[model samples]
Structure formats: structure tokens, C-alpha cells
Target: MSNDLFINLFVQITNMKQSFLAIVVMTSLVIVSCKKSATTNTNPQYKALTEAVYASGNIFPKNEYKLTANADGFLLKQIAFEGDIVSKNQMLFQLESATQDARLEAANNIFRQSEANFSDNSPILDELESQLRNARTKLANDSINYQRYKELYERNATTRIDYERAELAYQTSKNDVSARRKAWLRTKNQLYVDLQNSKSNFRVNAREDDNYRIKSFMDGKLYEVYKKQGELVRRGEAIALIGDANEVYAQLAIDESDFVKVKVGQEVLIKIDVYKDKVFKARVSKLYPKLNKADQTFRIDAEFTDEQPNAYYGMTIEANIIISQNPRVLTIPKNYLVGSDSVWIEENGDKKKIKIIKGVENLDMVEVKTGLTEKSVLVLGN
Candidate 1:
């Protein structure tokens, strides 16, 4: 209740408040310091590291082809449909071939007629042969009679007029024989030509018939069907697409910077969207010389070294082209790398930056060729 006592009490309260605030500030500082010390550190270790160039691509059947119609007609039937596995020379389509069939029939009829005319017992040839035989017999008889008449006339045993008649008859018989032989030869040549022409016409019709039936040239699975029954298809119209089902390859595109590093026969790892958890092994089969203008990427084709898993055409694929590898080398998680050749290391409980000689690197790990050892600790952070 005294004035001196009240002043003393106020002084004690103000001092106590100041002391509590000071304690709170010091405790906050200690907590902040402890939180900062919680850093992740990893020691470099020996591991297998691989360097790869990223690429995107798709799976395609080997020797894929589009089937086109060779002749124009209404599609009468589809012998093979999409998803059907067909062999070489297998019929895939049948166009309406009524006109071709008629043509073939007419041609066959003409060929049969020509063949009959050219037969060994043909009437025209037979008549010509009979006339030639008769003429030859007459010529033989006239020649003998002419010889006797000439001898008799020379000896004056017969009149000169009789000998002249005999000679004339002999000459006439010779002319008749020659004329008959020429007629027979002409008939034979004409028949032979007619037969050849008929045979040629028949083949032309047969080829036209073939055009109406579309056949496959390679063994493959028909991936697409472009025409339906009763649809009018023009010549050279694509009717189907086909490719080998068991044989497949990946067509990929890599960045232009990696074009030089990717070579034929290098190993490739392919990951497809459909096969989410599986990784397939493939080898670089071909390298295209030209770059893709749209994406500014180089093209690569790879074949599966192992049996290709059953896959559809044009499936999305992500691939890594392994450029180089280091086995059992000192490596660190790539996340710890700060730059192309630098990493942050912890030395004496403090963060220190060091430049390193780097080798093969991949999506997850980096190979340290020099400037780091198992004793070096790496500070991994964002």
C-alpha cells in the first residue's frame, strides 16, 4: 500500500517480462540452427554407370506395305480382313470380274476354233494335200510317156505332133504339181498364224482376269482394310496395309546433338507405353542420313535382338541409346550434380564446391572419373 512498495513491484514485473522475452528469442534461434543442420549427405561409391541419349519412337512391322488395287472394279468380296494373317500369293480381294470372265470365254472359244482349223485333219489342209498327191502321180506318168514319145519321134517311128503333145502334157503336170504345193504351203502358214493370234488373245484375257483378283505379295498380318464390299475401287487405290507380325523393329528419333554418338549396332533400351513395367532390348539396325525437318531430330531404326513381344503397329515408344558405359566406377546420384562438371561436397561440416572429371552419365547416376573418391561426401539438394 505504500508508494515506495508500488514502485518496487512495478520494477520487478518489467524485469521479469524482459527476461521471459529474452529466453523465448534464444530458444527460437537454437531451433532454427538445429533445423539448418539437417542436411542430406551421401558418400560416393562404386557402381555401374551408363550414358544414353534420349529418344522417342514407335514400333513398326518389318517390310510394311500398302496393298493397292491393280484394276478398277466394284469390290465383290474380301478374302482376307484386317487382323488376318495371309501368306504370299494369298487372295485378299475379289473384284467384280463379269466382264473379264466374258472376255476370257470369248477368247477361249476363238482359240478352240483356231486350234480345230489347224488340226492334222483340217478340211482345207486335207484338200490341198489330196490335190498335191494327184498332181504328182500325173506328172510321173506324163514324164514316162514323154520319154517314149521323144525316142520314137527321133527315130521317125511316131509323128512330131504326137511327141510335142506328150511333152506339153508332161510340162502341164509339172506346173500343176508346183501350183498345188504352193497352195498347201500357203494354207499351212495361214493356219499357224491364226493359232498363235488366238493363243495370244487368250493370254491377254487371262491376265485381265488376274487383275480382278487382288493377291498379296508377302506374308504378313493385314493391319488395315480400306475398301468394303460393293465399293467401287479405282486402279492403284489402297485396299489394305500389311506387314510381318512376328518381325518388328523400332523407329526412333534422337536429338541432333546425339546424331553423331548414335551408331549402327549400338545397344538400345526401349520402353513402350503398353509394356509399362518391361524394358526391351534392341540393337541399332539402321541410321538414316537425313534429319527430320519437323522435329530437327535424326532417325534411327533398331531390331529386337531377342524375340519381339507381340505388339501392334504404331505404338508409342521411348528409347535410350546407350552411347558408353563404365563398369564398377566411382559414381554419385546425378541429382547432386550442380553443373556439367561440378558437384557440391561437404568438408569440415561445411558445403564446398569441387570440379570433377566426369565420364558416362545416365538419368540416375553420374560416373566420376577423377577429382572424387569414396571418402568424398556429396550434399544432395535441389
Candidate 2:
């Protein structure tokens, strides 16, 4: 072959090789660009994030109490019924206690009779006082005669037998006075003891009879009436239940796993079934230390900040106890997350998987603590 023809063939082969390399490089670039467009792209946003633990609870009155019957009897009258606003010590029911009333009346009559017996002019005291006055008069006269006899004996002007007789009369009068005073004091003391006994009996009988009237011990609305009129109630049986409606509290059941996260004074977002459209605010007021083994939950009592939802007892509620919060942080939409610790990103026109360090998360957003930057573009909703 000629030398020029050989050289032209070599040049043609070299150009074809260069063209093939160019086509391969363009195809690779096209494939990478298509992959980047196929995925949804978004930027990390700076926003607030909150972490919380879920809990369920019930609504109850602040101070609830049960009223029980103090005595056994037939319920003749029920003055207060369900939904009645009652005051402290208000009569709620009356039991049939005719026997108690009869006993009280007899006690009062006995008390009155004993009181009359111990009055200022009692018959026994009057008779004793009259004898005491007569004895005093006789003793005074004998004392004067004894003085006269003693003077006469000293001067030897009277017989010794007359003077001795005068002394004996004076001694007898003194003995009479002492006997009368003793008798009067004994009778008065006995009557005073009987009077006190009667008074005590009356007070005891009155107190026993007063137990028949069922009274409210607290001021609040009566929410339940367990017993009705004409119902036979025994001692200490529950007659009604009542509580104050102005203040309210929630009894929450928290999962045992979240026991350490929850604490007193933490903010709680409450939602009640009755008030579906509203969210109430409260704070944890108490924490029950023991776990309810049957349900694997612990009890938390929360109190409302301001006005509470107007609700009855046992109303169901859902609550979220906010454990932590971050006001300013870079985050990604929680739905864009592939798993707990990783997300896909569009880096240099290709889909690249990168791991992230997460801090706080909620249903809306997740906080990105590290491994990703503000300039990084994320492939969302893969």
C-alpha cells in the first residue's frame, strides 16, 4: 500500500475513537441529571421543635366527697337531689327516727324534773334550812346563859349544880347545830348529782337524734344521689356524691416507659372528647410513685391554669406532656426522613445517602443536630 493512504487511515481511526469517548461522557452526565430531577428536592428550614410524651386521662372535680348516712333508718325525705347546688352543713335527707325522738323527749322531761328538785327553793333544802335556823336561835340563847353561870360560879354566887347544868345545855345546842348542817349539805349534794346526771342524759339523747338528719359537709354541686326517698339505708351507707365545680383537675395515666420523662410542673396540652375543637393548658401537680401493674402506667394529677372546661366527672381526655423544646434549629420535614437516622440528599446532581444526628422531633418536624448543613439540599418524599 502507498505511505499516504496508510497515514489517512490512521487519522480516521483516531477521530472515531475521540467521538466515541465524547458520546460515553455525555450519556453519563444525562443519566445523573435525570436521577436528580426525579426525586423531590427541599431545603432545611429553621423552626421550633418540641419533644413530648403521650398520655390519657380523666376529668374530675378538685375536691370531691361522698356523703354517707350516719345512722340506720328509713329515708323519709330527700331534700337535695342530683345537680343541686348545696352549701356546707345543709340538710340533705331526713331519716325516720321516731324512736330517737321519743327517747329525747323522755330525757328532756326527766331533766326538767331534776332541775326543779335542785332549784333555789327546793322542798328538801327548804325544810333543812328551817331546822338550821331554829338550832341557831337555841344555841345563841344557851351561850348567853352559859356566860352568866360561869360568872356566878367564879364569884361563888350560884350553886355548882346550876352552873354544870348550864354548860351541858350549851354543849347540846352546839351538837344540834352541827347535825342539822350535815343533813342539809348531804341532801343538797345528792340532788345536785341527780340534776347533772339528767342534763347529761338529755344532751346524749339529743346528739343521737340529730344523726337522723343527713347534712352536707362541703359546699358544692351534688352530682350524684345514690339513695332515694323511702329507701332503707344502713349506717355509713353512701347517700350522695358532691364536689366543687369552680376548680378542676385531671387524673392522667402515663406509660411506664415515659415515667422518667414526666415530672411535676411540666406543661401539659389537654384535649377532651367533649371539647374536641379546643386545647386546654395545664401543669402537672402531682405524680403517683407506684405503677399500676395491671395497665403498666403511672398516675399524674394535673391542674388547669385558668378556667377549666366545663365538664362532668369521668370525662375522657388526651394529653401531651412536653418534655423538651428548641426555639431555633435547622430541621427537615419529618415525613422526608427515610428512617430514624438517615436521609437522602441531592449533592452534585446525584442522589446521595447521608446519616444525620437528630435531637428533638415531633409529628411535624425533626431537629438536625449534625451531619447536615443549611446549604445541603434534601431529596424529600422518596
Candidate 3:
């Protein structure tokens, strides 16, 4: 080959090699740019956002109460068992009552005797009444005789001594009648007072006897029975646990930091272990004012607004109380935020950090209230 032709071929090969190298560099730059975009850049968009407070608690029946014994004795009978439905004032237990029975019997006997003594046919009162009657008869006869003797003495037909004696007899009879009547009244009053006192004492004894029985305070279901028949029970010892049969509520414990955000009538979303993956809707019904120092939490009660799960006492639950929500708002990925209230945005083909006004936020997304629009492109921070 000629030297000129060989030189021309070499030049052509060198130019092609340069062109291929340029193409490879451009391809690598494009790939790197795409990767950077995917990892660090996002755009604000309109989306629904919810802000909620997480809480954990258990299911409890309404008006839950512990039934306690009011008297100390051996349990003679247990009329209600666990899981039994009971009505108000229904007897749940009966304690041994021999001592109370004996006392009540004695009181009843005394009451009856006193009642009889207060009656008009009572022997003591009847005797006093008979004495009063006899004294009245004697007074009447002596009065007539005294009046006759006085007239005779005035007309000089009877001696003054006879008239004075007759007057003395009449005065004595009147005094006797007064004494007898006083005695009758005194005895009747004493008997009446005794009857009243005895009746009052009998009633007290009867009430003490009634204490041997343990009765229900309200209509409810018995959740637990602490004592069995033949067990010894003391006054004020828990006998059973009872609560309203048809109503149940969630008792949630909110952290002290989140308690300020909680209020009555707020919507709550609940997840119970028994009903896995199913969410139940409820509303906050109550908020306890006192803080639980042991756990540094406040108690909240929530009632189901929709269908509730079949729940037992102390069933574990997880709840999210909805603090606020935005159905449509400009939002960005949470990690894309730069600092407390700022985000990184792509501006004029360069990365720019800008402050943003925030609204509601959750774990993954944040509602951007101002300083960002749907057209804004957010960049993730390193």
C-alpha cells in the first residue's frame, strides 16, 4: 500500500475511537443523573393526610364494680356464679347466720312481750284500771254522804264531828281515785315506751340479720366470683365482679405528652388482637382529669360508633385517635423534609433549601400548609 493511503486510514480509525469514547461518557452521565433523581428528588402533590395519636388499652364493661361482702361469716351458699346474668337487688350469696338468727329471735320475743304489755288487756294495766274503777265508786258514795252531813250540821240535825268525819272520808276517797288513775296512766306510758324501744331494737337486729345476705347493686353480668361456697368471708372482702351486660367500652391510656391532643367526641380507630386486621370505629366518650402517676398516662374512654367486636373484659386493644385530618392538601414525603419546618426543593436546575409552613403530619407524610405548591419538587436530605 502507499504511505499516504496508510496514513489516511490511521487518522480515520483514531477519529472513530474518539467518537466512541464520547458516547460512553455521555451514557454514564445520564445513568448517574437518573440514579440521583430517583434517590433524592420528589414532587409535592395533593393527597389525603391524617394526624393521629397512638394509644393502647383494654376493653371494659360499663359501670364495672366489685361486689363485696358486708358481713363476716362463712359462706353458706353462692347463688350466682361467674358469667351469670343478674338483676338489681338479687341475692348473690348467703353467709352463715346462726348468731344473727339467735339474736333476732331474742329481739323478736322481747318485742312481742313488750307489745303485749302495752296493750289495754295487759294484766298490770288491767289491774290498775280495776283499782281506778273501785276508787271512783268509793269517792261517789263518800261525796254523797259528806254533802248530806254538811246540810244536817248546818240545820243543827247532825253533829259537827260527824260532818267533819264525812268530809275527811270523801277527801280520802278522792285522793285514792287520783292516785289509782295516775298509777294506771304511768304503767300504760311505761309499757308503751318499752314497746317502742323493743320494736326499734328488733328492727335493728333484723337489719343486721339481713346483712348476712349479699345482694347485687345493679343489673349486670357477673364476670368473676372471688369466693366459693364454704369459704370464709370477711366484711368488705370482694365477693365478685359485676358490670353492665350489654354495654362495653374501650379504656385507653394516652401518653402524658399526647394527652393534650385528646378530647371527648374525637374519632378513634381501634385494632383488637382477636379481630386481626379489622379496624373498628369509635368515638372518645370520656377523659379522666387525673393523671396516672404510675404509668405517666391519662385514661380515656371510647364507645364504638360502628359494629363492635365480641369483647371480653381486659381484651387488649390498640387505638389511633384522630387529632386532625385534611382530605386534600399539598404534601411531601416525610424524609424529604430538611429540618423542623423546611424542605429541599429543586429550583432553576439546582438544589435549594426552603422553609415551609406545616399543617398535619403522620409517620410517613406531612401536610404542607404554605411555602410549597403542587408544582414544587422536593429533594430528600442526606
TM-scores, one per candidate: 0.80, 0.77, 0.83
- For residues 240-303, could you state the per-residue lDDT of candidate 1 as single tens digits? 9999978889998877877888889987767777865466789999999897888788889999
TM-score, cand. 1: 0.80
Instruction: Write one digit per residue (lDDT tens) for candidate 3, span 171-213.
Output: 9999999999988888888999999999999999998988899
Top model number, TM-score: 3
Checking candidate 3 for backbone clashes, the offending pairs are none
Model 2, 248-295: lDDT tens digits are 799988778888887799977677778644667889999999999988
Give the 10-residue window scoring lowest on summed lDDT in candidate 1.
Answer: 20-29
lDDT of each: 0.78, 0.78, 0.78
Backbone clashes under 3 angstroms, per model: 0, 0, 0
The residue-level lDDT of candidate 2 at 292 comes to 95
Candidate 3 lDDT score relative to the true structure: 0.78
Q: What is the lDDT of residue 193 in candidate 1?
A: 100
Q: Residue 327 in model 2: shift from native, Å? A: 1.9
Candidate 2's displacement at residue 244, Å, is: 0.9
